[model samples]
Target: MAVDLNEFKHPSWITAAGAITGYLLILIVLTVALFIVPWLVFLAL
Candidate 1:
């Protein structure tokens, strides 16, 4: 499949902000999982 690069043109700051937001979201999910999973495991035992 051919992708068009022109369609992706945007300001550099916008892209950087998106990347930082994505990273923070991933960290939040991992932090929540770290707390929740152990509680679930303890409950299951």
Candidate 2:
């Protein structure tokens, strides 16, 4: 299925906030998987 860009338009700040939140969420997940989890596992072993 394809997404429609022009449907249900929102304010610009709302769109910006959503994009930033998504970006930050991706960073946080990568950091945890690549760094934090490895550190914890190293300490455990």
Cα lDDT of model 2 by residue, 1-45, tens digit: 999877647688679889999999999999999999999999999
Report the lDDT tens digits of candidate 1 across residue range 1-45.
999887667688679889999999999999889998889999999
The per-model lDDT (C-alpha) reads 0.88, 0.92
lDDT assessment of candidate 2: 0.92
Model 1 earns a TM-score of: 0.57
Off by over 4 Å in 1: 1-10, 40-45
Question: Candidate 1: global Cα-lDDT?
Answer: 0.88
What pairs collide in candidate 2? Answer: none
User: How do the predictions measure up, each by TM-score?
Assistant: 0.57, 0.70
The top-ranked prediction according to TM-score is 2
Model 2, residue 21: distance off in Å is 0.6
For model 1 the local lDDT of residue 2 reads: 100
